[model samples]
Target: MATDDLNKPLGLPRERKAHRTPLVALVAPPLLIAIGLIAFFAFGDGPDDPGNVVAAIDDTSPDQTGSVGPALTPVYEAQSEPLVEVKPTGGLREVRGNDVIISDPSKPRPIRLAAAPFEDLIEADENGLLPRIGDDGTRPLDAYARPAGATEGMKRIAIVVGGIGIEGEAGQSAIASLPGEVTLGIVPYGEDLPATVAEARALGHEILLQLPMEPYNYPDIDPGPNTLTVAGGTAKNLDRLRWLLAQTTTYVGVMNYMGARFTGDDRALAPILGDIADRGLLFLDDGSSARSRVGAFASDSAPVIRADLVLDGDTAPAAIDARIKQLVAIARERGYAVATATAFPSTIARISAFARVAEENGIALVPVSSLVRADGS
Candidate 1:
């Protein structure tokens, strides 16, 4: 009786044999379902998905069918507007109301002029037409000098670029490129004196007659024809000066070319300066002569201003730039500074670059005439 009962558990009645599910049977359905889902996502393109959508096209159009269009073609229409007249201001484009101000990098604002050869300012002498004070007490310094605009609180820098008209190309380059506030020192012996001067004046540069005077080495180093000399008496030097003044019209003053010996001698210099004062012209000392007696005569004679620096003494670009920095420092310290330079190509290039940015640095480039002090202060 008990032989069958050995395989069964000892339970109250004969327990029904329990059935166990196989692991594969339990997991196979879900595993198969996940594989199916991944395959569907990877390979199936759903109808409602934008990524699988295809654009419809009308293949019936002439352009798509390779047929030519008609002879009449559509044209684009745009409104045409007239150009406005722009006024030139230094290096900035400014807009005011409906007007536009454009900057001309090449053409600087011109200094105002009173027109050349005021009849009252000229007198016939043995040399030529000499500049003189008008019968109504007007001086050439006032008549021909470029009027200084409102400088106010800014530091003032006056630059005189000399040797213009001496070399044709260099002179033209200087005139064409330099700012209007720069004064030009025209040599007495340059060709086309009147025409060159007129061109420079038209561009707003104040003019100065560069008087050739004897240097320390006198005859060994001549200053060219009609040079004023310490040996030349006041009468003789005055004659030579008149010749120089006669070479050009509309100059505000005279600047010495090479006058170490001539300017150091007060006896020889005073009378010449006195004559310049009598003619109503200013006198500029180029500052080359350390022993110059110009200050001694300035109180009694022509208004005098000495150059604070010679910009192109070295003629290198770096040297010129360094000198310009020094010049600004001087101006900042004294409220005004004057510098003289030859019309060298390097000098003109550096000055042109400097002029474009001078105002922003609080430096006002004024005409040399503006800095001339009668008492030589």
Candidate 2:
């Protein structure tokens, strides 16, 4: 107290030091923290390290074990030409061409077996028409055969060989010449209508009888000797219709040869429509005239519509081509269209061209029944 009393206030011992000594110690911890934060912000993880996030999620470090497994790639081989794969069956096999592939090892592989080649369904003649196979054998004309150059679910064109003066062996030959998908429209004018009907049934083709009806402005045009008319009144007309239907035993439906006059009168045609509906048969209008009430009557009869716009009034190649284009255009606008032409060779060629157009355009060519069935559905 005596020595330090001059410098101190007489209560405590004097200890003098730098002004900032304690302050330095106190602020050192916060200053160090600030420096550490700056360093972290400047040099922490960044995009330069691509593996930072991806590697973290995938965990695909270079040190991982076990193989990742083989990479998948398509397996297709070069071929000289298109190959047709044929599976072995238990019957005699007849491969028509050398390019046909007997078996392929890449797939599950076809089981090899012995079987006979398919016998020709119809015995073909010079022009590709087939004769009735045998006296007892049924004729083999199916309406829904596979189409020419067809894949699964493709539309087909149907044609029948019996309507236009084709009979017996000649008729069979024409039917055979037709592609399998054509519907066989048979007229009863052949030598033996029943026999011809039997043959058509055997061919697996759809059979429909052509009904004779009264046409406008052409009363002399004969559908057949026994035809229905408005002149007969209700009972007689019904009887005549029943008889006409009975003429062909296995026809699934009927189309008018010419009926502009009779169809205009609903009173005369209603009973006939009832008979057709009662039999579960379809009515095809042929769309002869716009005024034809066949469509109007079909609502009650559950009738099918035939949207035929292309008759190819002329069979010239260019004319036929134009009509076909018109047909496709109409088909694209509507869901579908149906047109019929005579059985002349020129007509056949024209239709064949139209079929090609249908293929190119991805249009379907289904049967008349398909059109009818669609309405019911």
Candidate 3:
């Protein structure tokens, strides 16, 4: 110990003093954190303070100067009337609020039938003019139907070439090439539908309104705009149906586009069929779904016609020809048959060729209206 002490510097302390942290350093961090939290709770934007939030302001309020301001009472509470007011356009009926009142059953007379829509057969609505049964006991079904050919004691076949107005060139070709006896079904969603329908009618083809309806694989396989669905209630579906009916005029009947699920449900289908019957229009079941309940609910006044076969299920020419042969056999066995097809080139060609030899083969090619049987025989 004495030797080590001798080696050490004379002015240096033998043991270093114990180190201590400054009091301010230890306390400052926690004090600063507490102060920051207190300041945030007291002065920050809280639930009660909605800073710079914009809301709907009442334009009619004199106090509001169209400047950004705090939200007043809810806009809905300040008003008790409907958002929009609808007035009645001149028609057979007058619109009072949402109700339609017929003016006089004897006063509004039926207009003369023509290629254009009959004025008495139309009722004006918010959407457009919709087809309606005339007050003088005239039905659109009878007015628009192509006169049926003599089918007594002979095999009858009605071929419906649908999907007209969808593809412009193809539709025009179908209208030009096919015989007038083959009914043309017009889709409402197509462009220039009125013109297309007018052209078809001018060419002596009877028209059917091809309405879009919900299929089994809906949403994934949508039928397009204004498609009536099973999930939509009766009121909503009827409104949609009216919108479709207003698309064009001079169609003899309504045929479903694709409606597997909708036709299977009696609750959903009955009201629509009833509405069609009340308006004096026929309903054609395309025979796409075996589970369809159309016949059960159809009215006696306007019977529904179910298709015997679909001619172009397989769009190949040979397949279509074979189906046509089968259709002839069905007509021979049942005395009458109704067949539907798309406006495909192959289908149009096959049908055009078959139509030439149909009378020679003892088959009378008739319009769809000729096949309507009330007894469902």
Candidate 4:
């Protein structure tokens, strides 16, 4: 493991979603004409639509893409500002004064991406929600995987911009702002998580579900509701996990959200990681904890990638830019590097700039899936 010396001045932090339309009822005069339609143009085939919305459960699995090539130490974000509401985007957790992250407390609106879900991989439950395991292959993690196209000797770096699907506009901005090679880790709590995922896939970005996990602080510093808790036991935790997994498809794997406590116990987490593997998905440790045991458990079984840096722990333009440079340096030294960051505007903007400049610096900006261990994960 690379020491924190790679970059320490600014870094580590944790994890949002975003979109909706207004509903306007039309009541004309003349015998009280009834013309009330939800003006909120709900896009095609969303979760709320009549048919079960399966993002990408194709019956025929996509052909196997080529393999893993390579590749953090940063702080999770600790924003102290008061929460505020953003119009259209709704309520948000403000950061960097003007920057915002999508916040989800109550049930969210069913977000639908402009693109259609890949149908072959779908298997609908009684509720018409496609969250169960599919027969054969066709898992979204495989069907929608972005090809790495790694060269023989190029220094590769994989970057995961998480906290997606939280704040409406920020999430969209992130999808548009960064290149598709940057893997997006979407939180399942978002009302439009599946939709955000659709947009991500449309743009050729690999996706990962940011599974909520118990931080050591427990209820004090919660990752979010329905988080897989240590007390939840394997049965309960797996049940909640399946629900989360059903929220979206067309991604490569699963990532952690403040899982310091949940990942500490070897026996406690083994079944969870094992299940993720069984689902034909990979596991990514965001590296929030230097002492996390995910590395050990995943080593023998799952296809996993751990973070080398938390890009926005400092949450400032200069600090974030500096972290990018540090990330580039690590990639050059190790042949590959992976870093995780929240969707703060500063982080997104800085990473965007770095992606443009990375190739010029002799570094290849690769997807998170590309960084999985070489054993054909």
Q: Give per-model TM-scores.
A: 0.70, 0.55, 0.68, 0.66
> Best candidate per lDDT, number?
1
Q: Which has the greatest TM-score?
A: 1
lDDT of each: 0.77, 0.50, 0.76, 0.68
Output the better candidate (3/4) by lDDT: 3
Q: Which parts of model 4 have CA positions greater than 4 angstroms off?
A: 1-122, 126-139, 299-301
lDDT for each residue of candidate 4 in 1-377, tens digit (9 for 90 to 100): 35634433356421212333233322233224322223223343233444221121111111111111110111223343222222222111122333333323332222112234467655566423442235665555555567776456788989898989886777778886677778888988788766677667665578888999898878999888779888998899977887777777666689999989888877678888988876667899997788678888665347777899888889999999888888888988889988999888878788877877777778887788767744566
Compute the lDDT of residue 257 as modeled in candidate 4.
90
The per-residue C-alpha lDDT of model 3 at residue 134 equals 94
The better-scoring model by lDDT among 1 and 4 is 1
**Least accurate 10 contiguous residues by lDDT in model 2:** 55-64
Q: Candidate 4: minimum summed lDDT over ten consecutive residues — where? A: 64-73
Model 2 Cα lDDT, one tens digit per residue, 124-163:
3332322222344322221222222323444333333235
Model 2 spans > 4 angstroms off? 1-174, 198-204
lDDT of 3 by residue, 1-377 (tens): 68548534688855555556599986898899999989866765344543313222222211111111221222222253212222222212222333222222432221112468888988899888787889997888877877765666779899998999986677788887787778889999888987788777755688899999999989899989999999999999999999999898988889999999999999999899988888878899999899988878755675698898899999999999999999999988988889999999888889988988887889887778766732532
Q: Give the TM-score of candidate 1.
A: 0.70
lDDT of 1 by residue, 1-377 (tens): 68757545567566577877699986897899999989867655343433332211112111211121221222222223222223223212343343322333443233435336899999988777889999998888878877667798999999999999887788888887787788999998887888888878866788999999889888899989999998888888888888888887888889999989888898999888888899999999987778888877765346888999899999899999999999999999999999999999999999988988888999998999888742342
Report how far residue 254 has shifted in candidate 1, in Å.
Answer: 0.2
